[model samples]
Target: MTPDLFGRHRAVLPDWLALYYEDPLEITHGEGRHVWDAAGNKYLDFFGGILTTMTAHALPEVAKAVGEQAGRILHSSTLYLNRPMVELAERVACLSGIPDARVFFTTSGTEANDTALLLATAYRRSNTILAMRNSYHGRSFSAVGVTGNRGWSPTSLSPLQTLYVHGGVRTRGPYAHLGDREFTDACVDDLKDLLGHTRAPAALIAEPVQGVGGFTSPPDGLYAAFREVLHERGILWIADEVQTGWGRTGEHFWGWQAHGQNGPPDIVTFAKGIGNGMSVGGVVARAEIMNCLDANSISTFGGTQVTMAAGLANLAYLLEHDLQGNARRVGGLLLERLRSVAARVPHVREVRGRGLMIGVELTRPGTDEAAPEAASAVLEEARAGGLLIGKGGGHDTSALRIAPPMSLTVAEAEEGAAILERALRSV
Candidate 1:
């Protein structure tokens, strides 16, 4: 069964669309944190389809909202009044810390990011963009233009001129040996020097935590420090919160909050968790920036009634259950448990990340060499033991990504940890 479907998938889908495992499993359905393949084998889903399943599978609230909205109407153009869309936008605007915030909905993170770039470029009247090293925004031409990760970025031909910045990752770089404060100062100095040599960029877009960069992050307050400098230069700061928004980081509702002393970013882009499994994404910015464009604009499929309903329901559920608090409490324990296990594995080089978005990097014993093969072996072993996870890195694809639903139970976390321990040992 798996072989037949896999063949069909390869024949029809784009070759670049990746599938996991040597023999990929087709997920038939899911409930809670578990999913079953076509063969009826259940596995604990840790990656949550690249962290898109923000809440849980088959959540009653989301299903009911989607069903009821579908029965009424699936879509209505932006020319008409969309109650659900307006209501969801209101809720998000309030949640976003930006002053006098305004929201524009889109169908996916890629489109949301594209819209952000359009606004930033138009407002600043410049095409130059500042992007962090080992960062990924999206796959669209404009978004890809600013991405600094060579593995994910495919082309140099772009509408925007991009300048790469440092300090996204704290453990690996020329300044890796410096103390936290010194490292922050050095990166800020580098930014100042770069700005001196180049034109003023439209905005500096960055992911608070680099998801595809193996969950690497800089020291806290580094961005805030950078913010002070960018503000002096009349540049906009954009926070790419697709992966770190809606309380996934445990310590803060948004990843940008870790560096919030300088106030909110000029623009905030979000997607992944807001609609749970539904297709929803949006950009939030201060009224000045969001209203900068002089021309008419609309998203053909964005803010559709069905997706808006899902977003409203999902937001209410997430807040009602205090999933953010749950993430902090449970994630703290899970991180400790995983670190304990990693301590015994000779090939495990690092265990990092906050909240449920954890990463385990694999390397050759006694060296900093990325052991991509060892990561693959661990992934296969974990899947064979009925656990599903994810893998990513800067370019080598050598880190295990463990991001389960925000509502993960303690028992389930322990179960997954035990399986991961066995898998790492086997590898």
Candidate 2:
């Protein structure tokens, strides 16, 4: 009754599905740092499924856990209690350092953020929420409403209650050409001015590292200072770790941790690697603040049996294997190699980000305008050379983001860097 796996169908895949993938590669299967297409040609995954793969693809332990959980149980109604769900909550809370905290789980980053928005607005009894410019929360109505990127603004603007404000940018090494201390101060001042002009904000959401804003790491003392400003105005600080969480940044378990003493976020949202490719996302809220939400607020698919099993296994694999330490060491080596290559290319403007979350910015030989064509050419060249990476920033100009799995080895990192360097030269 079923068609052959390789059999052609009269109906082709929907164009909407094609819209999600900008690249031409058709993935069939994946393993550690490698993906294969229908032709069975392998490509090294430097992008790590857009940084969602923390333990690498088809991780044996993670797969084993999922298999075992599938054999045992898969889903349950929210009205009933489940062991995997309960244990996952406890582990996530403990690791996140939110004591006695309540967790609301979802299936994606946007859903998690949307839930947070609902809870914040309902609990705080405020219709206004302030988000940083150049931010990207998600595509859903409420979550997209909070996003501040210009490209997404047209689709996001509506009767949705939200306010967009620019956050502190980066302008130095490891994070360059972004807003600095002066910018953060100005942002705070702007927020104060906004508060005076409009209603008190319910929440102030930001990415500790602005992943979509060209990997902009806020200036030193920025988050701590922002925390103070938000607290003074009785607004909660919501750290959107959708792209920066789950130890991808290395040296720290979460991106907010890199903010030093000033970056302790009040509420943190996480997805991507938490389930190691399973459908799962969650929020770890400060115990006191989380209590503001009423019991009526709940999600149906939150902490499904299979998803929790996968999350627990993924966290275990990361911790037991010291993936974070590996990322820190290998990422440093890779960055040094990139810097060495940049020294040869006059067009390479900067290299930024910490650990595995890195970005390479290319520019004109003597001007600030980026050569997007050159960057794209280099990307395609790298793909031809067997390295799969990603491009970011609004113009698609300079910023090339590289966020491989934490399990990537020193040797693999070197190989990826070497290929990237060669690709740059070819372009």
Candidate 3:
């Protein structure tokens, strides 16, 4: 059955739509932090469907809310009033640190980011955008224009003039040898130099943690320093928090808080966890910026009733249970354990990231060359050992990404870690 489905998928879906594993397993169902394949083998889910199953698999609160809302109504075009949408928007606006925040819902992170780009360009009246090196925004034409990673970026054609900047990756760049303070200063200097060469960019879009860039991130407060400079030039700071938002970083409820010395970002885009797997994404900005567009704009299915209900219930559960704290505690243990294991593995290049968003980069022993084969081996081995993880990196796709559900327990972490340890050693 799985083979038949795989053949059908390949026949219908685009070839570029990649799937994990040489022989992919059909995930039949999930509960808590675990999922079962069509063959009835259970695997501890570490990647959480690319960090989408944020709270847990089949969370009761979210499921109940979705069911109830679906019974009443599934969707209504943005032309009409929607109670769930308004309620969710209010909660999100209050949570967003931006002053006079306004929320505009979208169906995906790509659309949310596209909306942000639209706002920034329209408000600033500039099509130039500054993006960080080794960063990814989304797959849309506008979002891909600003993406710096070559692997994820399929084409060079873009609507916006994008300038790639330094300081996204802390380890493998020209300033890798410098201390955090020195590194931050050098990147700022580079930014100033870049600005001198180009038209005033409308905004700078960056991820607090580069998601598809193998969870890489710049030093804390690095953006704060950049903000001081960009603010002087009237350049907006857009935080792409699709993967790092909603307290996933543990220390802060939002990833931008790591660089919040000057205050919240001018615009923020979010998705990939808020709805606990439902298709919910949105942009939050000050009213002045959000309403800058003169022409009418609306997403027909953006803030639908069912998705909003799921988001509300999921968010309430996440806050009430303090899953962020859970992520911190369990993720800390997981990180420490993985680091301990990686210390003895020569192929393991680096172990980095915060909270549940951890990455283990693999390279050829004693060399900087990425070992994508080793990463593939580890992925397959881990899956065989009843663990499901993910892989991502700059160009070689050689990093193992471990972002389990935020509600991960210590025991589950330990179990996954042990399986991963065997996989690493096997590779």
Q: What are the lDDT figures for the candidates, one per model?
A: 0.92, 0.77, 0.95
Distance from true location, Cα of 202 in model 2, Å: 0.8
> Against the hidden reference, what TM-scores do the models get?
0.99, 0.90, 0.99
Highest-scoring model, lDDT? 3
Clashes of each: 0, 5, 0
Candidate 1 residue-wise lDDT, 378-411, digit = tens: 9999999999999988859899999999999999
lDDT of 2 by residue, 115-169 (tens): 7776677667887898876787877888778877665544746535677665534
- Which sequence of candidate numbers ranks them by TM-score, best first? 3, 1, 2
Model 3: per-residue lDDT, tens digit, 1-427?
2789999999999999998999988898999999999999999999998999999999999999999999999998899999999999999999999999999999999999999999999999999999999998899999999999999999999999999999999998899999999999999999999999999999999999999999999999999999999999999999999999998988889999999999999999999899899999999999999999999877899999999999999999999999999888888889999999999999999999889999999999999899999999999999999999999989599999999999999999999999999999998
The TM-score of candidate 2 is: 0.90
lDDT (C-alpha) at residue 153 in model 2: 48
Alpha-carbon shift of residue 113 in model 2 (angstroms): 0.7
Determine the C-alpha RMSD for candidate 2 after optimal superposition of all C-alphas.
3.6
Task: Give the root-mean-square deviation of each candidate in angstroms.
Answer: 0.8, 3.6, 0.7
Candidate 3 residue spans exceeding 4 A from truth:
none
Residue pairs whose backbone atoms clash in candidate 1: none
